[model samples]
Target: MTALPLTEAARGATPTSSRVAAVTRLHLARRINVLVVPLIITAVVFVVTIVIQVAIQRATAGGSTAADYAAGARLNPAIAWAQTGYFVALGVSTVASTFPLAASLGTTRRDFALGTTLAHLLTSLYLTAVFTALLGLELLTDHWFGGFYVFDVGLLGAGDPATFAATIAVSSLLCLSIGSVFGAAWLRFGPRGPLAISLATVLVLAVVLLVAVPSFDALTTAFRPWWLVVGAAALIVLSVGGTFAFLRRASVR
Candidate 1:
C-alpha cells in the first residue's frame, strides 16, 4: 500500500472481528498488485496465445488439418500454468512488504494472519471467477469462434466449469499461502529464514522420493485425485499456520 492509514483500534475493547476486518482492508488497500496486474496478465497471455496459434495455423495449413491444430493446442498445457509464476511473486511481496507496516499500525499478529488469509480467499475467488467466466465463454463460443482455445483446454478444466473453478481456487490459495509463509519467514528470521525453509523442503522431498520410489508404481496406481486434494489442503494449512507461528514469535522488523 502506498500510504496505509493506521486503522488500529482506539483502545478499550475493540471487537476481534473489527480488528481482523481492518487487517483485511489494509492488505487489499492496494488492489493494483493483487487484482489489476493479474487481469492485465490475462489479457496479454490471451492475445499472445491467439496470435501465436493463428500464425502457426497459417504456416502449417498445407500439412495439418483442424484436428491437428486442436491436438497441438491441447499439447501445450504449460500455458495454463504460466500465470502461476506471477501469483507466486505476488504472494511473497504481499506479506513481506505489509507485515512491518501492519505491526506499526498496532495490528496484532493474530489479526494480521486472519485478515491476510481472508484477503487471499477473496482474491482467489475473484480471479477464479474471472477465469471460470472466460472458460464458460470459450465453451459457449465453441472455443473462441471455433479454432482457438485458451481456458477450455484440458489443463484448465477443459470445459468443465466446476473443475475449472475448483482448480483455480485451490491453486491460487496454494500459491499465495506458500509464498506468504516464506515472506513470514523472512520477516521473522531475516534472509536465512527462507534459505532454511528451502533446504528443509528439499530434504523432505528427497526423503519422500527415496521412500516412495520403490512402491512408486503401486502408489501411482492406487493414487486418486482426492489424494492430491487432501495433500494440497494439508499444505495450505501448514503454510498459513507456519506464517502465524513465525509472526507470533518474531518481532516486526
Candidate 2:
C-alpha cells in the first residue's frame, strides 16, 4: 500500500496538536500540586496543634498542660503569617532549583523561575491574609468552635499586633532574600545546590540567633514597626532584583 500523501499528513496533525494540548493541561495540573501539597501539610499541622492545645487546656484546668508550657504559648495568629512567609520563601527556592517539568512546554527556564517565585509571593500573601482574617473573626465575634485556650493563645492580644506584624514582615523579607539566592544557586547546580544553601542558611541563622537571643531582652525595647517595615522593604527589593538578574543570565544560556 502507498503511504499517505502530504494532505493526509496535515489531517493527521490534528491529533498530535490535541495531544499536545492535553499534555500541557496535565503539566499545569501537576504544577498546581506543588502549591497544594504544601498547603495541605501546613493546614494539617496547624489543626493538630490547635487540637492538642485545646485537649491539654481541658485536661489541666484553665491554665495549660506541661506540654503547652514547654511549647510556649499556643500558636499566635501573627506568627502564622511569619511562618507562611518563610515556607513560601523556601518553596520558591526549592522550585527554582528544579527544572520545568517538560521541555515541550517551550517556556524558557527564566519564565519558569519567575513563575515559581511569583507563586511563592502570591501563596504567602493569600495564606497570611486568611490567617489574619480568621483571627479577626474570632476576636470580633463571641461564638467560636474551640475552648477558652483558643481565645487566649490564638489571638494576637493587645500589645502583640505591632510586634507580631514586625516579626512577620522581617521574617518574610529575610526568607525571600535568602530563598531567592539559594534558589538561583540550586538552579545553577541542581541537587548539591540545595544542600549548600541549606547549610548556609542554617549557619547564618545560627549566628543571628546567637547574637539576637543574648540581646533580645534589651533589644525588644528598641524594636519598632518602622524598623521592621524598612528592613523588609530593603530585603524584598534585593531579593526580587537579584532573582531577575539571575534569570536574565540564565536566559542567555
Candidate 3:
C-alpha cells in the first residue's frame, strides 16, 4: 500500500475523540487473554483459597478454629497474589505484540499510548469490582462459605471494601504499567531493552534503599495506605511517559 501523506492520513483517520477508543478496541481484540484469563485466574484463586481455608479449619479441629486461623493468618490466606505475574505478563505481551499492529493500522503513537492506558484502567476497574463483589459475598455469608474464609482474609482487607478495592486497583495498574513499559522497551530496542531497564531500576532502587536505611524505622512507623496509591500513581505516570518516549521515535514496520 502506498503511504498516505501526513495531511491525508490525518484527514482520513478516525476523529480525535474516537481514535483512542479505536486503539483500545484494537487491544481488546485479544479479549480472551487480556480480559477473560485474569477472571479465570480469579476463579481458580477463589476455589484454591477456599480449599486451603477449609483444610486449615479441619486441621485445627481440636482447638477453636477461629483462634487457630487467626494465629496462622501470618501465612497470607488470600492467595490472590497469583494474579500478579499474570497481569505483568499481560502488559508485556499486549504492548509487544499490539504496538506494531496498531501502528500498521494507522494508529498514532499517542493514540496507542492513551488507548493502552485506557484499556488498563478499564481492566483494573473490572477486576477490582469483581473482587469487591466476591468479597461482599464472603462477608454476607458470615465467612462460612463451605466453612472457610474465602475472601475476608487480612491480605484482602479483612472485609474492608475500600481498602480491598484500592489494593486491587493499585496492584493491577502497577503490574500492567510495569509490563507495558518493558514491552515498549523491547519494541524500541530489541531484547536488550528490558534488560537495560531492569538493571537501571534495580540500581536506582538499591541506591534509594541504601540511602533510606537510617530512616527505615520512621518510615515504617509513618506508613499509611495512601502511600501505596501515591507511589503506584507516580510509577504509572513514569511508565506511560517512558512508553510514549520509546514509541514516539520508533521506526516500527
lDDT of 2 by residue, 15-98 (tens): 543434433343234544444654565566557666775676566675655556534544445335535555655645444633
lDDT of the structure predicted as candidate 1: 0.82
Q: Best candidate, lDDT-wise?
A: 1
**Candidate 1: tens digits of C-alpha lDDT, residues 97-206:** 98888888777788889989898888899999898888888778887885777776776666678888888899899999999899889988999999999999999999
Candidate 2 regions with alpha-carbon error over 4 angstroms: 1-35, 62-94, 97-104, 108-114, 140-143, 148-180, 195-218, 245-253
Off by over 4 Å in 3: 1-13, 74-78
- Which prediction has more favorable TM-score, 1 or 2? 1
Question: Against the correct fold, how does model 1 do in TM-score?
Answer: 0.91
Quote each prediction's TM-score.
0.91, 0.56, 0.90
Give the range where candidate 1 is weakest over 10 consecutive residues by summed lDDT: 2-11
Residue pairs clashing, model 2? none
Candidate 1 Cα outliers beyond 4 Å, as residue runs: 1-12, 62-65
The candidates, ranked best first by lDDT, are 1, 3, 2
Best by TM-score: 1
Give the higher-lDDT candidate: 2 or 3. Answer: 3
- Model 3, 92-156: lDDT tens digits are 87788888877777777887899898988888888898888877887788765454565666776
Please give the RMSD of candidate 1 to the true structure.
2.6
